[model samples]
Target: MYRKSKSNGKATYDLREVVTNIKWSTDLNFSAGELTFDLIQNAHPIIPYTGDIITFRWDHYKIFYGYVFKYEVKEDNTVSVTCYDKSRYLKNQDSIVWQSGTIADRFNNVCKRAGIKHKVVDKPTHKVSAEVCDGKTYFDMVKSAIVKTRTATKHMYYIYCNYDVVELRRAPYKKLKIIIGSKSAMTGFSYAVDINNTANVVKVIQKDTKKSQAKSATAKQDDPKRTSFKSTSAAGKSTEQWGKLQETVNKKNKANHAQMVKQAKDELRKKNRANKELTIDCIGHIDLVAGNAVTIKINDLGKTLKNCPILKAEHNFGTDYNCHLTMKVGAEWLGNS
Candidate 1:
């Protein structure tokens, strides 16, 4: 079942009977689901439009909550609407200066400016000195803040939209109790190990800004040297086989050298993890979402996959009250619960 309403209004309309089809997907990296649905135009009085709110549910479980941004009236008298989770609001470009604080504070500030409703589930223990978002999109700025605020022990953070609220939470230390297999709820499963996009080495180059140079000059008059750039890399499993495939990132802003190095390592880790991936298709698991940890068992594979993080999920609901999902699962090594 699903509900639709104006962006910030109280009125809502149930859409279960009129719902024709749905395609909803969410990814940890993007922090929002690309949700779309089609509804038959009948005697219903409600009409979906831009900036409308949508909430999807499967039985008693809330599946998705988002805002419709696009709609099309089909020739068959049906309407197709495209929506994105609350994080979609962060895509709007803005400029702002942020004072030093924790990752939670930075994210909350961005949400405040963007008018995005949010909740910080996990707060970063570390603190950042200062950051500036000069005409950058809120998404980019918040992502950078998250990268910079990660702890030295390599604590991982996940930012995503849950229902109507934006969430910034620590990566799960404990795996979910649910299992996926032929005998389980999973209906189909496939895996791929592609080295084409795998990168063994990641090099990050952070350029020095005028402010950094000034600070350097003030801190050391005798040395009188400016840290113009910093670079770091990490080797992956395919490093030996592929002879070290290198990926380089150029950052225009100034950041701590150690932090930049960690960022590069994190990027490399993600790439390595993506190289070996499994796609599990099953009937809709209402509670399953990106950033969730779940176990998988395949009889033919002869081994159980444990503590796998969902990288993406695609949900489909069609006629006959049937709903299904295809989830992309992979390994994440931030540490164990």
Candidate 2:
């Protein structure tokens, strides 16, 4: 959508008519937003070359931006272009030691070093501990910092790129009050619930300074934490429903016992549920991208599900604009860090 002029200039082509089959994909599990479209070479007197900036905007908001990565010209004088947002650069490998500051601070540091423009939304104040990376991709280090924050402060966040800058946001950053139901313009719908990753028993293991394994089954009734000598915690829920799907966590002497106990409880809360996903497609809304929340009101599902988190969304533009999504069951499904 834009070109890098040899002189200082600012402009973008109005590509609405010359471009066709535009597709923009955003996924929480993917590193970047992607776009592909066909450009009619002859429709315009001049066409930008490779490495030119491309962007898509809807109304007042700029939705996607990236440089032209690939382009193919055919006998028909039509060009196929593929682009990816700035987060694509996060795939590059690096090594560093982040000693202090919240996850937001760490992300900003990474962006500065990588020469990528970035912004932050809904910051988490809890500071993450020191982390040293020998060799890891920038994306991997960011994910690692997120996991550390989740373990310590129990807050969740996600990353994406739009409007020419990478954005780090708390999970479900964009919230809409609108509801989607069976009456919506749905082309397809499928909701599934499975217990594939359920767990009811969590065992905590500790190794001594001498490098010996230790597991004791003694505790003091007077202590509320019950962490005096406990190494395992089991959910009160009947194991008959899910027979002792066990998980384990290792800790060092430096970690407090109470923290370990709460860690076990956290594991149980996250793993004991039936993971539910509702996949659907309808007429596209520019705002309906990933890392947002949508309300669902179907007949079979009661009030148990509201504000479901969107895991991925793909908006296809051709004859019509349509979007489909993969969404989780409830707000907790996204926030249960």
Highest TM-score scorer: 2
Residue 21's lDDT within candidate 2 is 80
Candidate 1 has what TM-score? 0.73
**Decoy 2 TM-score against native:** 0.81
Q: 230, model 1: CA deviation in Å?
A: 14
Tens-place lDDT per residue, model 1, 200-317, is 7888886553443334434443333544665776677776666777888874366577777777887787666445667777767655667676787888778588867776667776
| lDDT per residue as tens, model 2, 91-194 | 87889988977878878888888899999877889887788987888887788888778767667787888678798988768777777766675667788877
Q: Global CA lDDT of candidate 2, please?
A: 0.74
Q: Which RMSD does model 2 reach against the true structure?
A: 7.3
Stretches > 4 Å off in candidate 2 = 1-14, 40-50, 59-61, 73-78, 206-231, 236-238, 253-260, 300-304, 331-337
